[model samples]
Target: MTTTVNQVMTSYYDAYNSEDPDRLAAVLDDSVILRSAAGTGQGLPGYLDTYRTMITTFVDRMTPQRIEADGDTATVSIVNTLTARADVPDFMGMKLKAGETLTLNLRGRYKVRDGRISEIDIELA
Candidate 1:
């Protein structure tokens, strides 16, 4: 398939925008791997599950600020403001409480295969 970088990126964003794990899964390769500034995971599903759990933990809404793609890769820059619903350990291991909004700048990179992401690397920007 002649999948362009833009198409793959659009699929990835659509999956995230929908917040549907199944939809996200549809665009992930079975053997996908992910590495973040926080940590790394073995597969795409596991990576998605971890973030989903975090969203349930203390995040209210997440928004993307920008996205860029070239060849078989894409990068999404995001500004995420999260409200702590309960005391949770952040990346810095601080105790955060409800109603506290933590703003973070993040960059995520995707490696695509057949219009699906087979690997990802994320970092704090």
Candidate 2:
């Protein structure tokens, strides 16, 4: 059976919060593209690299405030809370020291193909 867009997005967020690169990659297409203020990444390898960096640098948690899906597309409003694991001199224009926490309100537009996420465009909410 084919997965619905909502199911794909739910799996994506669950994988992200799990902080397992392998789990997150499972929900992504091989050629997935992710665009955000931090940077843009293409392909599974690039995406995994970004995920590793973020998890290593901070304790990150993504909480979905709203999720709306139609056909193969999904739009999600999220609250991302990050507690620095190490001093980050600059992160998306913010500086954080170890033990410090920062929260961001974000919106993400996702495109799903087959049962995987193909593209994600993220921005500040």
Candidate 3:
């Protein structure tokens, strides 16, 4: 059986929590798009690369708090807490801590097609 949108979202979050790029890729369409407060990506591979970098270099974990769907669209509410590993610029480009836990509220919208995520719109809370 094919995966449902909810299952895809759950798997995506699980992949994220696992910090595994290959796992993250499994739930996304090849042409998946990600739009967020941090800009956007055109494909799943690029998104996976970004996630891999974030997980390896900056973030420690990202957890989904809730999920809801309306037709083919679904929203995943998540809480991401990151532990800085290097001196990285903040959202405004200001240099920040090398090791600090930063909590961010996130909401991501998934557009599903053929049981895969085709588009994702994300925002910071």
Candidate 4:
């Protein structure tokens, strides 16, 4: 059985909320690529580091407001509320420290292949 792109994204949010490494890896493919304003990462290791930062620095929540899918690709509009528990390093060129909180409007474009996320691009709005 294969999952839809939306399903993959839902699992991604769930994994992030849970802060479980294994669960995070389970939602992606071996060849996944993650791109954002901060940097680009190829494969699981690359993505894992980004997730690690979130796991360590901030207690965050990603809420999807809109989702549009066609075939193997999808676009998601999201609201991310983040509260820093530690000094978060160089996020989009800014340094964030504990006690800082912000809500960001962001979008993510996803590509799914074989029931796993193959690629994702995130941008701020």
Candidate 5:
């Protein structure tokens, strides 16, 4: 398969939204680092643990508004729909009540290495 930065990003989101850690891992380097408002995770195991928490804590979906790629780097602007699960954790400086939902604009900057994601940094919009 031909691997492009866009393809890598699509794969990353596809795997993430599907809640498939194994597939998600396929697009990341073993030394990958993910940083966000939530927290930071390093390497494959750290990422999987973080994903597990997300799967358990919230039902979230991402809508990409823009994708820009240059060389092995890419940036995506996205709208996120987030709904708290029954047992949700605190986020965005607020305690989530049951069934509470939020819509947020976010951005993700990524770097690719050998057709895999080497780093991702997320920021609020």
Candidate 6:
């Protein structure tokens, strides 16, 4: 059986929300590229490093408001909430004290191939 684009995206979100790096990695192609406000990352190692940094610095959650897929491409509108685990003087140009929460509306474009995510581009909505 083949995984649909929706399924791949669902798995990605689930893995992200669960804060499980291994599971997240499982759904991503080794050569995946990620572009977001933080920066661009190529390959699994780069992605993992970014993931670890964010996860360690804050408690993050993504709520998808809408998802649309065509062929192997998908776009998702999401409401992301991040609570500072500790004081952050500078985080993507934002400062937060411990327990402070930041919410952002974002759009994520994804390309999946062979049941894994090959590329992702995230931008402010």
The CA lDDT of each predicted structure is 0.75, 0.93, 0.81, 0.85, 0.86, 0.93
Instruction: Supply candidate 2's per-residue lDDT for 82.
Output: 95
Best first by lDDT, ranked: 6, 2, 5, 4, 3, 1
lDDT of 3 at 88: 73
Stretches off by above 4 angstroms in model 5 are 87-89
Off by over 4 Å in 2: none
Pairs clashing in candidate 3? none
Q: Write the per-residue lDDT of candidate 4 for residues 13-104, one digit (tens) a residue.
A: 78878879789889889989998887888999878888887767888888889889999998999999888898777666678888788789
TM-score of each: 0.80, 0.96, 0.87, 0.89, 0.91, 0.97
For all predictions, the C-alpha RMSD in Å is 2.4, 0.9, 1.8, 1.7, 1.5, 0.7
Please write out the lDDT profile of model 3 over residues 3-117, one tens digit for every residue. Answer: 6778878777787788777877888889999897778898977888778778767866778888898888898888988888887776445565888777889888889988788
Q: Which numbered prediction scores highest in TM-score against the true structure?
A: 6
* lDDT digits (tens) for residues 16-44 of candidate 6: 98888998999999999999987788999
Steric clash pairs (candidate 1):
none
Model 5 residue 10 CA deviation in Å: 1.0
For model 3, the stretches where C-alpha displacement exceeds 4 angstroms are 92-94
The order of the candidates by TM-score, greatest first, is 6, 2, 5, 4, 3, 1
Q: How far is candidate 5 from the true structure (C-alpha RMSD, Å)?
A: 1.5
- The local distance difference test score of model 1 is 0.75
The model with the greatest lDDT is 6
lDDT string, candidate 2, 16-62, tens digits: 99999999999999999999987788999998999899999999898
TM-score of model number 4: 0.89
